[model samples]
Target: MGRFRPGAETDRFGIRIAASGNGVHVTLCRPGRRPCIWLHLATAGTVADKATVDDRPEIAALARRAPRLEARALECVRNDRVLFHDLDAALEPGQVLQVEGPNGCGKTSLLRILCGLSLPGAGEVYWGDAPLPEVRAEYYEALAYVGHRHGVKGELTPIENLRFHRALAGGTPDRVPGDALAHLGLEGFEDVPCRTLSEGQRRRVALARLLMTRRPLWILDEPLTALDRSGVAVVEGLIRDHARSGGMVMITTHQAIRLEGCVLGRLRLGG
Candidate 1:
């Protein structure tokens, strides 16, 4: 395997990519760490050679600098009718964007398009100046998505579910499963199947995954769905800390949220 540095500058998380005989390798280097840690960032098929990676300004800058997400003239459509059109927005590091509108105004559609889950009928979504399709693997590596569904297996205990989530990431998490559960107020329910938990508790479990994920961009859809006052505060605190740490967030919520130390922006659909 040969190591390649996109540039002398470091990525937001101090990551480096190396080309191996079979695929690309991503490593995280932390200050004072003797050896870099391997990250299981998916590389779609063969990666570009060192020169190729460096040649693309978008890819190079994404690997070596702060990143931005942009949508230009996005149009969301359903059936044969258009739901919304001409939407333009940009989300920068250390900023939170809230998407709001009446029911069926395409708030969910817009979020889906921005997160690459669905395609826009018109216009383009870019991650650091490159179209999302061209840099999918890299963009996904930096993204964490939480949608309307709880996304947890009913049969799996909270701890088991969390561990499975970490396994899928293919990287060591910053926090352990138990610690994450505790932080999300799931301490006593850690070993029980999520099916037995209350709606709010289950929602907490879903949101707890954010704590273990080290991704820089969070795309959340109705993150406050079933949470109560305290739970809502927890979600707000998480967003605040993430923004303070230079992470970007795009969220959809019916309830207003306050992030004291972070810049918050809003996009209203069908307005």
Candidate 2:
């Protein structure tokens, strides 16, 4: 532990400290005050002899910066009637919005509507004041979606799978660097065939796309299924950094994800 500086920076959700002990502990969290994961910054004694803390003044300057909401909706419904009503909400860039509820509660359906993959029965969804369908191309360009499936090709190698994903997403092949694979702890298996990988390893390969895709909005469904502690840390860091950089995220998970400084809005199904 080190001397804690509370409220040192406004936009900063967590604190950075220069620890005199073995290492500095950095906790990644969502804006909703939930703990996502923890990061251990090894002290200078390990790899290097000394380290310096970056000045907080620059971070403090961002305190006044507010994220702009790019999406707005008046109401949402399904099948020409109200499935879930009064869905008035605004999603700001750089915000992490979590959707929680029981099974078949329209959580996934709602996300589909938001992403314009499906249309709302009655209400409308807008992207920066324009109708979602009108800006579908622009919206898709800014969005990255991950559903229940890992979405990786079983016949392709890890690198090949990532390359295919990039191509399908209209991005150049090999756009994702090798570091992305290493970050997910998939160093040796980068060139290995996907079918031979374990379930967890396959999931890691799918998750590796998060680092590769730089889309602004992340719509994820149950993203933490096969991840271990370190894998969870990687995802948490990705979410934190995405929000900090003015990107938006919408995630639905049965397990609790501890996040801090996030403006949490929820839609509970079945009441």
Candidate 3:
């Protein structure tokens, strides 16, 4: 929920507020320091109407305590063939689940099921101690999904795409759009349209969103697909830091990647 009023500016604690038709954007700042997240206020009517991830019990518990993602008896069927049959897994804070298998092994399907992009044929997914549906919207706030498609707009520059994702997620909690692009090794290529960038560059643009938000759960599918050695190293390093700092990352990679200081878990989907 929002703590500031729109248009009528509130500087009680150096909070900057601006109003739009139905939503509000706020920048919380400290003396001589960069502003924090540009928060999204769901509505302009009342503070109670402003939706925040913490306004819900499920998300609040997740943030306040150790977060875990659990999948029980997850099953995926295709044309009467069982891809995943009664599959089960659990992911905790500071952990990485690397879904590994050969092609056509339903690795993507399992990850999709975990990310709520697809439903399981049999069991359920739990966030913290509650079912996913109990905290669906808030769960999304804490989740960052990067699929095989790269999720980039062909006509948009890397910076534009990153900024677009930032807006979608409410704000850039860490690096700004430009800095995130630069950090992902897309410095001079920031202004180039994705259509012109190499395969690896486009993947980097998609990954730049990771720096834009501080979501705890990362669902990445084949993040190493278009990366060169250096790019792969960068991605590995990001994954390591995320887990080390108590964030959870679920990745699908066929390449050999060693994550330092993480409790690694593996799942074979079609086995």
Best prediction by TM-score? 1
Evaluated at residue 87, the lDDT of candidate 3 is: 85
Instruction: Show how many residue pairs clash in every candidate, following the order shown.
Output: 0, 13, 0
Residue 24, model 3, lDDT: 57
Residue 72 C-alpha lDDT in model 2? 41
Candidate 2 lDDT trough over 10 residues, lowest sum: 1-10
- Lowest lDDT block of 10, candidate 1: 1-10
Minimum summed lDDT over a 10-residue window in model 3 is located at 56-65
Ranking by lDDT: 1, 3, 2
Write candidate 1's Cα lDDT for 230-266 as tens digits.
9999999999988776689999988988888688998
What C-alpha lDDT, on a 0 to 100 scale, does residue 39 get in candidate 1?
42
The Cα error of candidate 1 at residue 61, in Å, is 13
What is the C-alpha lDDT profile of model 3 across 1-271, one tens digit per residue? 2233344443333455555565555665543468774566565455343445334433322332445899888888877778878888999876899998889889998888888888888889998888888889768878899999878999999988988898888733567888888778888998888999999899998998998987878999999997999999899999997776567899999899978678899887666
State the C-alpha lDDT per candidate: 0.79, 0.64, 0.77
